[model samples]
Target: MKTKRVMIASEEVEYDIIRSSRRTVALYIRPGGSLLIRAPWYVPAYVLLKFVESKAPWISRHRDKLKEIRPDQPSTMINAGDKIPFMGRELTVRAHENSRNGIYVIEDEIHVSVYGALTPEKITAFIDNWYLKEARNYFAERTQELVRLHGNILPVPSSVSIRKMKRRWGTCRSNGAILFNRELIKKDKELIDSVIIHELCHLVHHNHGKEFYALLESIIPDYRQRRRNLRNL
Candidate 1:
């Protein structure tokens, strides 16, 4: 692993260049905005630099796009004995050895299944993948469900993107593509609808104005309460 600094647009970007047996170089920006470049160890420094330079514009745009959607609150850490909110209920965390499984949910509890040994890192990784997978499937389904229910309010979004957003709940773009916070899967369905509706309303009115609220209210009579509940969550 090596740490390299390069100028991307106006910002000085520092990234971790990790070499592995992998055949391709991949660039990614993790949460808290850490950049990583995974590549073959044999790649030359000049080639890597040029690759970074070529991706500088994309890197800046990608970070800026995320900035438009994250929330204002600090991130929450998931651990054993901690309860997670899901579909309007708190799902308790429980870990057990499954010998051949990963994780699953039953009733109001989430079960983490492992094979031989367990560590905090392994548990965390399992839960992260589980939550993201759950979020992707559930969010995609709900987006379609809502579109069917309220497409008259506005047509369903052309597509939906799910990601681990920091501060914001969701963002509806001008192109009819919607970005949803994966964490929203933790909230109750009603609150989730309010978020979808809010963004959908943005398609008609891009600002928080009287008409936007009026449109939202038409769809969600208790939008105010639902928004408050999300804050409390």
Candidate 2:
């Protein structure tokens, strides 16, 4: 494996080159926009560079698309008519001037009513505020239900917290607090429940070793599938 810096359009992107006994060259962009190129061992560096250069436009477009959906890139501008994910579905955001300023979800769409001027900033404020509100109510409701069902087997967390987390879905602290990423409000309930149950398991076993996963399995049998689905988000 070798690393090479290639210029795509005006952006300098680093691509990892893996040489194997394969027959052809294949280019791919990983989840976080890391570039990977696979080629036969006989292929030379100059040939790979040429191929990447030719595919630069396509690669750059895809890289941007991947970056836009990255969990940590939450600061990206949320514009009107953009599709926002909430509870496993994508809803179109529509902002309009109204006497009352509020947000609502109806028939796979989000309606944002702005009492004054309707701008991108105004819509963003509405969306951000909406997500936070939903996160609190949704996560609280789920924690209560899941705890009621699994409280008999696992040690319950001392407290459950829902907050903004860029790179993690949830965290389990030794202090017996479970912090869930508020961004997960956009995801499905199963994934959220998986994360909550995961942290709850940690209250009994702090480590992710055999004992922890064993406890997790005993409670949620299909946790691995839910974890895989979470990554796709």
lDDT of each: 0.76, 0.81
Q: Give the TM-score of candidate 2.
A: 0.65
Put down candidate 1 lDDT per residue, 56-173, tens digits, no spaces: 7788878765545543332555667778777778888887765444577888888887644554544665677677777888877887888788877787777888877789999988
Per-residue lDDT, model 2, residue 188, is 87
List candidate 1 stretches off by more than 4 Å: 1-81
Clashing pairs for predicted structure model 1, backbone only:
70-167, 70-168, 71-166, 71-167, 71-168, 88-188
Instruction: List, residue by residue over 1-233, the lDDT tens digit for candidate 2.
Output: 13357888887787666554569999988666767787876777799989999998888778888855553344666788899889888999988887656788889989998756676755876688788878888877788788888768766677777887879999988888878898898898788889889888888888889999999988889999999999986
Backbone clashes for every candidate come to 6, 0
TM-score of each: 0.64, 0.65
